[model samples]
Target: MFRNREEAAEQIAARLEHHRGSNPLVLAIPRGGVPMGQVIADRLEGELDIVLVHKIGAPGNPEFAIGSVDETGHVELNPGVERYGISPDYIDSEAERQLENIRKRRQRYRRPPTRAEGRVAILVDDGIATGATLFAAIRSLRAQNPSRLVVGVGVAPPDTVERIRREVDELVCLEAPAEFMAVGQFFQDFRQVEDEEVIAALGGESS
Candidate 1:
């Protein structure tokens, strides 16, 4: 419905202007969120950084997330994460693995951290699907004690939107599709966001 992701991001930037002037930090879920987050960083004259989160997948069916892990080893489980027959130790082990990935990504993305604690943390993503990643992203940001935690997405489902809205101080979403499927389905040019592009965006202070 929007002209594209950039236009959608720019609109979000307009609504979020107050935070920008107040030392707000924009954190993008890498690979996809970087581009949109970059536009926001530029408009707001704030700082841009990456917040890493890995989904805790269902046993055997690894693609389905039972929960998620943040860069700081924060674990959030679904109502019945125990139904997977996994132990606390096993989940901790997975958290360690994800933390390692987060480290690698931080190095690759140039390790930009604008002030996680006191600043407003505006988490961005190209879009939201099952809300698993976005859920993890918000919980992770919350642990950092940001003055405000916001979830910004180009699109999401209404249910996911409502749930996330409760957790964050603010939510700037362009579209809540009636029948949400994959995040890519809504984008006309939803290509894979490359790591190089993420690095380049980080290097120049996109915010």
Candidate 2:
């Protein structure tokens, strides 16, 4: 999308100049976010890291996230949990199942993903869906008491962007396509970001 990832990163990088003086640490949500965060960090001359999380899929449909779980296994459920009259026990059970995936991802991605303690922490993802994952990551990062929390992405729906803005201290979204379907839709090269590639990028193994 937009020629390649560079173009999207540069566009998002422009919004991060204010933090350039202090050099915020970029935390890319693994997979699609690694490349994007690597570019932003390069442009701003900041350190790059990775934030790992897993979606808490709905019971029947694993692809649909009813919530999300972070590296530490903290779960945040959707409003539907209450609105749809789902039980807390059910939510807890689903969260536990997702936590296993989060643990595996963290082990595979980074032996120990660094915490953003008292640092300017930027949360980067290729994009946001219902924002369940982003929200969980933000909540987890808040516990570290980062000096700043920024949500950066290539694109998202306008309403989702607004929701993210409310949760994060700032938002650096490039495009909020009105008819947005999936994050891959806006990308010309929406190829799957392999786990090894994500590690190479965030770990600086890739040149």
Candidate 3:
């Protein structure tokens, strides 16, 4: 397992060095991804920003994501969503609710949204689990017409890696173990990342 998020970021940074002079925008999924994003921004000399995505949980099993919604109101449903027997009404209401939360988060963050029009967009998360949030985030980024879209993560399931790889221009993931169960399982210190930490990390150029 990796020592911590720092070590993971440093390693990912090495793989991302080619973007250093290209001015890629590193958008992180807070609150766990902020630290990793900060390290990437420092190493690549890129600007740091946030991409807030809220998971649309399955009915009765809130931890299990049926889909996700990004800050821009773009929703991504899992291909297996219908098998879960979730109704369209529930998905609509849940998406609206999560969008409101994203609204509040952006307001609380108080940072002007980054312009993704002509630059490469790199979305970073601590890791991927169901891949719902990252999928939504990638779709949203794609809508902005970025020159390119990339995904960087510390670890993920092999299936998830393959699924996301097709969606982005580049995928820089450190590990995709066959026996993976959760993102935290690959980290030596996988603690809860708080909102305060996210805010502080964004306030600085790097962490």
For model 1, the superposed segments whose C-alpha errors exceed 4 Å read 204-207
Q: For every model shown, what is its TM-score relative to the native structure?
A: 0.90, 0.91, 0.95
Could you give candidate 1's per-residue lDDT for residues 16-74 as a string of tens digits? 88876776788999878988989998888878888888887766777888788877677
**Which pairs in model 1 have colliding backbones?**
41-207
Question: What's the best-to-worst order under lDDT?
Answer: 3, 2, 1
lDDT of 2 at 169: 88
Candidate 3 regions with alpha-carbon error over 4 angstroms: 204-207
lDDT of 2 by residue, 1-207 (tens): 576676788888898988886778899887788888899998888888887777877667789777887867688886666666667788788787778777877767655777788889988888887888888889989989899999889888999888888888888898898998888778788777888887687563532
- What would the per-residue lDDT of candidate 3 be over residues 1-207, giving only the tens digit for each residue? 998998999999999888998888999998899899999988998989999889998878878888999887888998878887788999999999999999998877767688788998889998998898999898889889999898999999999999999999999999999998888989999989877777777783322
Model 3, C-alpha of 25: deviation from truth (Å): 0.4
In angstroms, the error of model 3 at 32 is 0.7
Count of steric clashes across candidates, in order: 1, 3, 0
Comparing 2 with 3 on TM-score, the higher-scoring candidate is 3
